[model samples]
Target: MTGHSAVGWVDIVVILGYLLTTVYLGWLGYQRTRTGADYLVGGRSVHPIIMAVSYGATFISTAAIVGFGGVAGLFGMSLLWLTFLNIGVGILLAFTLLGEPTRRLGHHLGAHTFPELLGARYQSKGIQIFAGLLIFVFMPLYSAAVMTGGAVFAATQFDVDFEVALLVFALITAAYVIPGGLKAVMYTDTFQGLIMILAMAYLLLFAYTSLGGVSAAHQYLTGMADLVPAPLQAMGHQGWTAMPKFGWGATGYDLWWTVITAIILGVGIGVVAQPQLVVRFMTVRSRRELDRAVPIGAVFILFMTGTPFAVGSLSNAWFAQHGPLLKGQVVKEIDAERGHALVGLMKETSPGRWEPVINPKTNQPATAPMVVVAHQPAQDGQGAPVDLVSGRAPTVVYAKGDADQIIPTFINTALPRWFGLVFFLALLAAAMSTMSSQFHTIGTAAGRDLYERITGKHGTEPSVLAMRIAIVIGLLVSVSISYNVREEYVIARFTAIFFGLCAATFLPAYVGGLFWRRATRVGALASMTVGMLVSLFWLLLVKAKEASAIGLVQLVTGGKTSLLADYPNWPSVDPIIIALPLAMLTLILVSAVTKPSDPQHLRRCFPQYAAPQATTL
Candidate 1:
């Protein structure tokens, strides 16, 4: 911890190796792609297992690793509930209920993009156009969020410039993606998935071992919890294993209400709405293949989400005995036990058992014992520690209020230099693999819906070239937003927002056009229009704090909250909550008021989905 190894030759070797391996895989995929269909949908020949990995990788992004994992660090293991939600709602329900039907419909319609499926099923150009435009706009915002997360983590860990890291990420990802297309993306996603699983396992075992197994670490944290000083301890502070008791109860119910609802529903329902992800279903050969792939995707999602949640929970103890800068902030940066927890865990666990070697300057083991001086005596009711904060011992777990960079900070500190290199390579792979999928999905949205269908015949080879060009255009635009824009948005936050809009607008219309026999073109249009507009309005008005805080006058009269609160603003009600309901109501009532889609057409549109699920949610 004292004299850490700056990233050296081994680290550079590890990164370069990953880059070469990725670029080569992309080239191999390109060699396999011969036609537009092959390139766009992997020739509809991609094995179900490969397709499942592609789907899993896209879902488990930098947002999962860096952003949400860090969130777990502050919020505690309670956030681990998301793992169940991912496997249960996102994977199980999504695959068993939605996957086969979507696959059958896509094959029946010969669909390439999500927009095309909507257009083909109902025979409506407007629906196609509307869906295309939605992808063109919203998908980029999501891409930018992922890019920003990769850039920030790279800069913090590798000593690279932030913007430079971002641009490098953009360029390298584009190189492999555009040249090879979906096949390349899937191959690379599969490889990256394997590395991610192994790296996380290694880190988990190392963390527990370094902390003197689970029991010793728990004891150390509990002892430290007893030593927290007063005043500081009055605020929320507790050990890693214990649920925090800051009057907010175990999970801080109010905040948890919003987070759990947002994420569980966001991811659970959101997985269905993702245009990019859904298109992958079009490539599967059969319902059998989809069935075969389900277990693979489920296991991957479980490990990817579960590993990070576990690591983040113990991060408090990891950093305490290793690095305790605290940055001299007024609110003490971290709660007494939360801040100290991580380092203390490391102190108890590490293999190169910590010894106070003489500092040469003072000789005689420097000033004092490393662990004892930092030992902090037990605390009383107010939780004061004499040495660390108050007279009493600190809590076992502590929270660093701000959450942007804590997880990466500890990994960079605790792991051996070589392990850090592997992790960096693994993270970079996460961003690149997912970005490739994003680019492919967006390109397909343009190529099939806007370019091919409208013209009757597809655009010439040049039109296909234009699709490739659009990928660059999309990446540039998303990168611009990632670099220059300063918005108050989290990756998952926007994902849920946009997803709710898609579900409200598309789910009912898509279903009705295929099975209900009650959906009309007019109603579909109304649903999409209302759903999109209401979502945007809510985001702009209700979601932003100042707009809500000041009410109507302040919102209209040049809002003052942006500069004062530095919120950069947020859109309201998270779109899905309200906009979706409105969209569904508009679709249903409008269908009833007017004419239903042709019954013959409805049967052709969905034979399987209309047969019905065994039960309702």
Candidate 2:
């Protein structure tokens, strides 16, 4: 309630104008779309700049800006490693090493979707159907993550109900995607990407300027190490400007493992196998187009990802200096039942009576006061208890201080009134661009790869119509999941889960088919199956965070959080670390033992290897 502020008429007009222009572009794409190819791959003639921007925009979603940015708020500047990987692995290697081959193979096989490309390379309907089903089923989790990030910002910005914001956001994105397909998605993505670049640039400049330049801001953040919550410190948090403790803390390398394995590597390497992003390579006409796109894509990613991470880490400095103050008293009394000290923050208006502290900004009772309860009363680490008699401390509390709302709270409270509107538009663009691509990919997976292949209906008209209907169904599933998924840092967690799953399931087989002539259909199939099952098994029974949230282990085992809860660091390890290696080994062993692919098929897939050799007479 304290952060709520009504939008001005000017803001409303600008939002309406942007929405109208987006709708017009979608209509234009609909008018131009004439074939299934156009709907799925934009006729394979998209401009390099547009394609690059679309790929970058789709790759960097609200999940990046809001969800992972929030994670940066807790984990600090260590998240910047992900940005490095985004440029190196996601753009450089992806466009050069993998992009050209994926484009050529997709064209050679006349494939439009990612699953179709892999299926054609292996020449197996089972592979195609399995890949399609995998995508259509689990992709909703990612779609929901992106949607939740957008809705969280929207709800914070407009003071509207979260359900309403989510529903409207989904509808607006579907209006453009279902009718216009990939063409509309790319066309609108170009515009959205530009907006994101501008807004993020402004935010970066503003955050640094407001905090007294880069060095001073970092110094301030580093100096506030003691401000890290006790719970976080025990888990390995060192400070806002430094990485978490390396090997062990109270929980035995739990934070270190989660950061390196689950967050950094899980999403960093996972981008290579993302079905939504891989399909972008097939949208361009030639390798030259892909070549031209590499730098543009790299620069786009650098700004898109780098800005949020820097700003998210620096927000603690700004909040500590300018955030609201809380007035309360720290009470420590012995509990009769437990015979231990009970410490809490309370406000007393009359002697022998206490009430909840009311925030002056909102005139509402504060939910989470800036107090850490322990067996003994909390201390400020300076050897003095935290003002036990008159607990008046300058505290930063923004809407429960939830990680998902950190960026939103900063935008709304720390910046000028007008910039809030601008940032909101940027977030809207981010959410829509990513959601459009996701919905489009899932639609093609269900309609073209699964339904058409299974039912033997390959006609253009029915395929296009089926894709349109499938988009609607996919949206419904995503929205339902978004509504039901309520957890702290849900966006970041779900994004990592989906990315890890894709990397484990698809990376081994996709790379093998493209680069290795000996990769057989059976090998690819076996790898995909093993990768997917192994990843799921790890998520449901091994990884502590996911397994505990899902409650599957708890239900099956009658109260265990994970299968390996007794182990030191196994529960914290990501599925990608465990499953990706096993998957690669499976592909190699199976392909080596099994018969190689047909010579003719290998010739078509690897043309350079098949080039006729000149013999000397």
Query: In terms of lDDT, which candidate is strongest?
Result: 2
Best by TM-score: 2
| Candidate 2 global CA lDDT score | 0.83
Local distance difference test scores for all models: 0.64, 0.83
Runs in model 2 deviating more than 4 A are 248-250, 324-401, 460-462, 613-617
RMSD of each candidate relative to the true structure: 8.8, 5.8
lDDT of 1 by residue, 140-203 (tens): 7778767877776677576566688889999989988888888888899989888887887787
TM-score of each: 0.79, 0.89
lDDT of 2 by residue, 210-256 (tens): 88998989998898787676567777888878887877433735778
Off by over 4 Å in 1: 1-7, 211-253, 320-400, 452-462, 486-489, 511-517, 545-554, 557-573, 607-617
TM-score of 1: 0.79
Question: Local error of candidate 1 at 129, Å?
Answer: 1.1
After best superposition, candidate 2 residue 468: deviation in angstroms? 0.5
